[model samples]
Target chain A: MDTQGTFRQTVEPALVRRLQRGELAAFETIYRRFERAAWTLALRLTGRADVAQEVLQDAMLKAFERARQFRGDAPFAAWLRKLVVNEALMQLRHDRLHVIELFDETHADDDAPAPWAHADSATLDRALNRLPDAARAVLWLYHVEGYTHLEIAEQFGRSTSFSKSQLARATKRLRELLAPQAEDTPCTIGSTTTA
Target chain B: MHDRLDHHRMTGDASLAAALRALPASTPARDAWPELASRIRRRRVVRKAVWFTLPAAFAAGMALTLAWPHLQRSTASPAPVRVAMQSSSHATPPAAPDIDALQASSQQWQAWVQTLDRDGAPLDGRQLTQAVALQDRIGLVDLQLSAARNPSTTVGLWQQRITLLQQLGLLHLQPYLVATQRPASHDHLISM
Candidate 1:
């Protein structure tokens, strides 16, 4: 669509260039486009909407401060997501109990509708939320943010073994959560799919 | 049996992954953008101004100090030196109604005021006055020493005055001293 093409052109190249020059207007534009994505990630990581709001502001401020260093080689969205994630983790450390409480609530409310009840992929969301911070971060970066395990380890200041172990643990836990849901869905008699 | 186990694992993992993908996307709250922008702008201005002025201020101070030898040897009459010292020393004292009452204020109390400022703690107006009086005392002595016939004593007085001036410079940057100078460190930023 023309709208999609226009957004790509007007948003990416010009936006990156303007941000590189420290233009507030350009930053506002980027914020408007990506604020929801950043906030969602923050909320998921921290659980509380208030903490998410703080993370959003803190992340954007950091992004603006370091905007000059951002090379346009990576998509701005991915870079922004990483910043949001880092800020959320930093906030978690500061508050200490914020993420832990969220994790506990998620696990305790197994009977309650999953947090991502509105999504077609609700089961996966529940599984990811139940993960430990380090593991959850790796999974989100890998699947959602589209980073390689090697890249995730480098960003996390951990070795590749740690990154892989986290991913393995996340996958194992996800499988356990998804098994019940999978069983509940009645198998169609005419379905050719083996599972 | 192996094939069945593989199917169960793969399908379950995929389902969980999809659910994870589906966690509701959140929109950023509206109020944060402007506040963050303001903070960034404030920090940038403070850092840049500090960098530029800190070096220049240090350089000018060192140049003046280095020129001390030449200026001292040039045996001008005491009249010109007296006039310069008087002009520089003309800073008005605190306009407290009870100047005499404050004159007897202990130097220890005044030093506490200075210490509070150095530690980035707030001081009361009375304490501020005491600190100012102490600074004035040092400055006056330095001016007098500059005009003195005794060279060794003059050097000692100037050194003491410089130390006081350095303290004032650091204090000027404190948040409480917003009405004064905005602290932007350049050369000896860490020391300041």
Candidate 2:
């Protein structure tokens, strides 16, 4: 599928203009187009489907209210994604769920290959879900969302080292969780064979 | 040995990252549009109400503040001539031309009130109460002005009374102004 073409089709300038004029129908169109992607990102950030839904609604409303300010400098989808991230962070802050670890002491052991390196997406998602809020957020932003450590730090109001340390600890814990499963399954199929 | 370990870790990290990136974006179980639309509409209504109510409240507050001193002055000075003059002004035309002028002014006030009731915008409960209170205050100041022994004090009091009457008229007309002069964008709020 042509992903770029699909994205371009969803947020046409004409639709954006209509939304800027406070057209409810245009807003509904944008919501329908991006709701799944928004909800998924929100769910990942917040770790709760209910809270994710709330975040999606709030973020979309804010986007609609400030639609006039959108200068079309970036794709509307990207802007909306950023807004969802911001909303999710705000929800986390409000709930006091974002706990930042002060030190990288927990994952100081020798670097080891993640045992479940060859695990399917479901197992990986489960492992991700088990991570602490800050760790999960850092990993998602850094590895998945392509946010730089500095950007992650800015979002979380922490230093870049804070993002780095949280990511290290999260990766370590995920490896440990997947190690047991790796022991059961031989590292034969597409495994990073260790010497 | 260190280089081999680093290679293995890098491969593992790449594999893990791929799995995460492959995670499918899931659709929500329910449609959020209905709730979202309702919320947006409710917010617009609240904004419009605030836009209208604040100015009306301010006008009423200003009228009360301006009328308060005159109301107090009227009650303090119990002038018998003022009472007699007010009574004669309402009941009959005074023989004196100046007294007749006072009677005409009083009649004009009655006509103004009638015109406001007929032509002005309908008042909400709060505005109606303020208008009534202001009318009562105006009556008290009128009595006080009629009884003033000093011509200068009478003139000042008359001016204050006229200002109060104008304010009271505005207070009565405020709801109409809010309804008619509202911006077109606010129409969505009412329609919703």
Top candidate by TM-score: 2
Residue-level lDDT for A99 in candidate 1: 38
- In model 2, which runs have C-alpha deviations exceeding 4 angstroms? A2-10, A98-111, A185-195, B1-13, B66-192
Report residue A149 deviation for candidate 2 (angstroms). Answer: 1.4
Give candidate 2's chain B TM-score. Answer: 0.40
Worst 10 residues of 1 chain B by lDDT: B183-192
Docking class of 2: incorrect
Question: Model 1: per-residue lDDT, tens digit, B95-183?
Answer: 22222222222232234335445444354576567558768877697578658654334444554555565555455445434533423
Local distance difference test values of all predictions, in order: 0.57, 0.69
Candidate 2 lDDT by residue in tens digits, A1-195:
534212233588999999999999999988888877788888778777788889999889878987887889888887788888888877776675556544446553456655555665555666677787888888888887888999888787779988888888888887776677567654333311100
Q: Over 4 Å off in model 1, which ranges?
A: A1-10, A48-51, A89-131, A171-195, B1-8, B64-149, B171-192
Sequence-dependent TM-score of model 2: 0.64
TM-scores of all models? 0.59, 0.64
The alpha-carbon lDDT assigned to residue A130 of candidate 1 equals: 59
DockQ of each candidate relative to the true complex: 0.20, 0.21
